[model samples]
Target: MPRPSEARPSGARPSAQVRRFTPAERWVHRATAALMGVCLVTAGCLYLPPLAELVGRRRLVVTVHEWAGLALPVPVLLGLASRAFRADLRVLNRFGPHDGVWLRSALRRRGPRPAGKFNAGQKLWAAWLTGAVLVMLGTGLLMWFTRLAPLLWRTGATFVHDWLALALGVVLAGHIGKALGDPEARRGMRTGFVGRWWADSAHPLWRPGD
Candidate 1:
């Protein structure tokens, strides 16, 4: 009788799964998403007068928004405890020569642009989101603490915070739209594994041994 491996169809491997995001990465992503949603919803309540009146509990809403914004970095900080997460951070921070080519091709709706764990667009989003969060948090703290700064500074912070929040909301919608449109991309975050073929075509540079 033939061995089990030999009995299988030619070119069919016993293990076809490709590891994508690690458990730590997935957990951070989910936690951040949940907290971000809370922040956005509460911000909406505070920003819109009609919504604020309907909610009728300004103090409670403000408290929730403040805490949610503060907690946004908790998951990422905790995930950094994992070596894999740290390694992936290093990968995300550095952009290669291919990234520019990928961006151009993506904009033109051209052929597949080989990318590693994260393509250029994803890296850009990550960087922008990080900076935005930090800005929001700093300005939020300024607005909340009241006496920490002069009235003029506090007013400026509030103005910046309000406009940035609006921009963040739009960017977040686009992010969700992109994720929803790509089932394979969503699966990587949802299950921490991606089909080998999907990985090969979407992120060829991230393949095994690459």
Candidate 2:
């Protein structure tokens, strides 16, 4: 084993890192995220008075909304349970000394946007969003089943669920907004393989043997 002094240089080309996510993992993430997004958008629109009027079929909209909400977490939960997903979680959660520097520099348009496999912001986003989903799901279930908690608490849970949903929606919007602003990022998830430069620049803290 090599000592720290003998370790590979930071900028040196690394040995080939295998494509991490398998097709099933990709499918699960995409499907769940897509469904969750649709559920949020549709439900949010419907919640607004004007959108309720604009919707052609109220019952159909509600049905689809409910179904999508239920389905959205399946893949995410599955991913969380798998080792690959857990490993991904670790990489995303890893905060490096460079992350802060990159963040500060990026504020001035000099930050490492494509530094590693994931960056500090993206990791934090993933962690919080997933946690928010879990909370919302729990509250949603209590409301749906109508007997998990006290009647009063069940009502309160509804309020909590809606509030968290709204908060999560804001974060989700920001996440997607950032992705859309950079076509490379949008392509990463779409193609399930981001460019070499993107990984190098965006996620400098991420490397193999992590």
Candidate 3:
């Protein structure tokens, strides 16, 4: 076999990059994020007295928040038209032996653990956020159309919605922090491609098929 230096011409760059996301997947993610941001901002303005006073548009804020929350699931539903997205959903859903190992290693602060395209933490976050968004939507609808439900139901929905919105905000901040710290991950989500070296080091078990 040829030596490392002889494997390619001098100054040649590595070309083993891979596509990390599809165009449809990227679009869906962006759309969902946009809608979620709108919902969060509006919710804050509606709930916080100082923010509400500064914004000074109660009716408009409420309208925007309701509409944004209701439409948050649209992009994911539309993304189901793409085979790639559906395949990724399956990957995110299944927890294999490596997932357990990865989580254990993570908690123990051990050295890097083998992982696939999505790690155990990412999979859990995705599953949780999906459920949370759906619940928020349902509760929001109940609160919006108050006449559709009785007083007790509306009261419970309001309680859940308020607490869940706070939780979502905190979780979202952590997600953004992680994304900001990982340039390769940000690049992959933004441009749909990631360096082969990054994949090899961070997600050793990841394969193109996965």
Candidate 4:
């Protein structure tokens, strides 16, 4: 018979659960999402003729879009007060040796691709969104304050901004699709805790201590 110390009680809960995200992280995510939705909706009103007609206020729509774009970084900046957010930013900024392996494994749909707290895909998405936001903000400011730049430069900025917005929209759709498909990932962002089994299977390198 197994020793009392080694034996597990029937129906006992596992203690391997880990904190996936902090409260600050979830707040930042939700705030950013809300602002992004505002930007996208206002953008649609400004860009689409039918929507613009329905809204019947082009100037107001443009103002909302510009301000929403400007405010995109606010939540993230505020969330930086949390040490976990700063640490996650560092992790997202640097690609680890295992990242390439994880990507390859994901593409092949075989093997257990161990990752840290944030996987390669998540890191890539974060980097892309950050760069896209900066691009949009800069171009948007130029467009907003027309006299700040020459006519040619402003025109070029408009072109770049419009095309980049389309690309970002596509990327956002993919991001949302992946999130919707993964309930555990959504739960992690929602409640900040994730099951140990999920952590081990999806991110084996992640530890409670880490």
- Which candidate number would show the highest TM-score if scored against the true structure? 3
TM-score on alpha carbons, each prediction: 0.90, 0.74, 0.92, 0.90
Rank by lDDT, highest first: 3, 1, 4, 2
Off by over 4 Å in 3: 1-14
Pairs that collide in candidate 3 are: none
lDDT of 4 by residue, 89-121 (tens): 898898888999988987997765768888888
TM-score of 3: 0.92
What is candidate 1's lDDT per residue for 128-156, written digit by digit as tens? 99999999999999998998999999999
Task: Locate the minimum summed-lDDT window of 10 residues in model 4.
Answer: 2-11
lDDT of 1: 0.86
In model 4, what are the clashing residue pairs, if there are any? none
C-alpha lDDT values of all predictions: 0.86, 0.68, 0.88, 0.84
lDDT of candidate 2 over 1-210, digit per residue (tens)? 532213334564554233535565677768877888888877777688888887768778877877787777788677776776777767777877766766777688653454356666766777887788778777877877876789998988888988888887888788777766676555545655554444444454447445
Which prediction has the highest lDDT against the true structure? 3
Residue 136, candidate 3: Cα error in Å is 0.5
Cα lDDT for residue 17, candidate 1? 74
